[model samples]
Target: MTEDFQEIVETFEFLDDWEDRYRHVIDMGKTMPPLDETLRVPATKVDGCASQVWIVPHIEGNGPEAVFTFQGESDAMIVRGLIAILSALFNNVTVQQVVDTDAAAAFAQLGLDQHLSAQRSNGLRAMIVRIQSLAQNKLASDS
Candidate 1:
């Protein structure tokens, strides 16, 4: 998962210009795993995305070290890549880590805002909101 982020950063670094970067971003999107159809429900759908998106989060075990798993899908390839990037970072993290982590900062560290379109940036925010909300809910339930 960390490797994925490194690869993204490397790809971003390799591009000489925005046009090349856009193509690289699209290539990154192509690598995202396909979303499961059965999980696409209104409750799972992430709002604020230009395309249809669904996210499912599952917490296993207890305490601050417990693992959180996530599965997601999006109609747009770029969005799917965004989901993939997020899942790689957030999945398997503890609930406390999820709550404490700054997703936007991580994206910034990867230069996502500079490389992605405004719509894609909004979609990424929507995805982060959904993941964070799920983590918060799980923590509440666990408490």
Candidate 2:
């Protein structure tokens, strides 16, 4: 659904090593528009991130079929890039899609699992958990 996501996959597939991939990710983060200051709040802050990360969900449509989008930011460049990847995958999609997505598998298919440090891996997993939780919460509220 995201053009950049496809581009990213293609680009990563082209790159031979993790070095270039890391740079691409950092570059993606550098280009990401800054998050609104007001959106960063205690309630929105994701726990277990190595950096200060905030995620907010926006929804459209109605009832159980409503679609959701996420906006997020992080103090760390790597973390921000991680957020971008998640956004690319989950943004502007149905809550059920978010719940069904195999985020870890997607990352692994990109060879990110082997490249990520323990802290980064944990942070990434936390982000996925948070996103899924948001979807689940919306489903509950919409019921």
Candidate 3:
């Protein structure tokens, strides 16, 4: 649903080495504006991650047609970069589209699933689940 996500895929394709891709992910995270400390509440806190992570959803408009966007942060640099990647994955899309997206496939395309630690992969799945849950909730309210 976002061109930025496609751009990420293309960028990943351009980077041949894992180390360069890793740095690129970290650099992507560095570019993200920090999430507000006050917003890092228990409600936003993501479990199942070794690193502390928070995601706050911001939905605009009503129902399935609503836009889905979120602000996320993580204590770990790599996790923060993953959050940036997720932002590119889900931001500014319709709630319905968010619910329908194949996030695992997208990440697999980026070859992230093969490279990430098991814990990090689980954490990434957790983040995607959280985002999808938010979108589902939006759709439910619309119905």
Candidate 4:
């Protein structure tokens, strides 16, 4: 999964400009499998996003080896793209791995902060926090 993430980052690096990168991000969002509408309820909606966003987390097993799965959606294309990147990065990772992952670093690696609007960046941080909170809850439950 890390290798896959690295590949995505490298791919993003190949794009020439922010406009092209935004298009690539939108394309990534388009590739995401349709998320279940029922999962898009208020409880799942991530707060502070500039657009509507939903996140559903599923944890399997216990400890460092526990698998964490996430399904998410966002109304805005760029926001959806951010979710797609997060889904690719965190999905199927262990609970510990999810908790340990530095989402801000990942965004920095992708040059997100430099290119995105402040509102979009805030939304991105909200998304990361929501996912990390889910992982933390799973860890707490396991203990």
Highest lDDT model number: 3
User: What lDDT tens digits, residue by residue, belong to model 3 across residues 1-143?
Assistant: 48999999999999999999999999999999999999999999998899999999999999888999999999999999999999999999999999999999999989999999999999999999999999999889788
TM-score of each: 0.84, 0.94, 0.98, 0.95
The list of candidate 2 runs beyond 4 A from truth reads: 1-4
Candidate 1 has what TM-score? 0.84
TM-score of 2: 0.94
What does the lDDT read for residue 113 in candidate 4?
Answer: 79
**Which of candidates 2 and 4 reaches a greater TM-score?**
4
Question: Candidate 4's residue-wise lDDT over 1-143, tens digit each?
Answer: 47767878999889878888889889999998878887889999999997999998988898778999888898888888888899888998899999999988887888887988899989999998999898888888778
Of candidate 4, the 10-residue stretch with the lowest lDDT total is: 1-10
Q: What is the lDDT of candidate 1?
A: 0.78
Global lDDT for candidate 4?
A: 0.88
Worst 10 residues of 2 by lDDT: 1-10
Look at candidate 2 and give me any clashing residue pairs.
none
Total clashing pairs for each candidate: 0, 0, 0, 0
Among the numbered candidates, top TM-score falls to 3
Query: Which is better, 3 or 4, measured by lDDT?
Result: 3
Q: On residues 1-143, what C-alpha lDDT tens digit does candidate 1 reach at each position?
A: 35556676677678768677666656666776776777898988999999999998888987666688888888887677777778767887788888787888878866777777788788888888889888888788777
For residue 134, what is the lDDT in candidate 1? 84
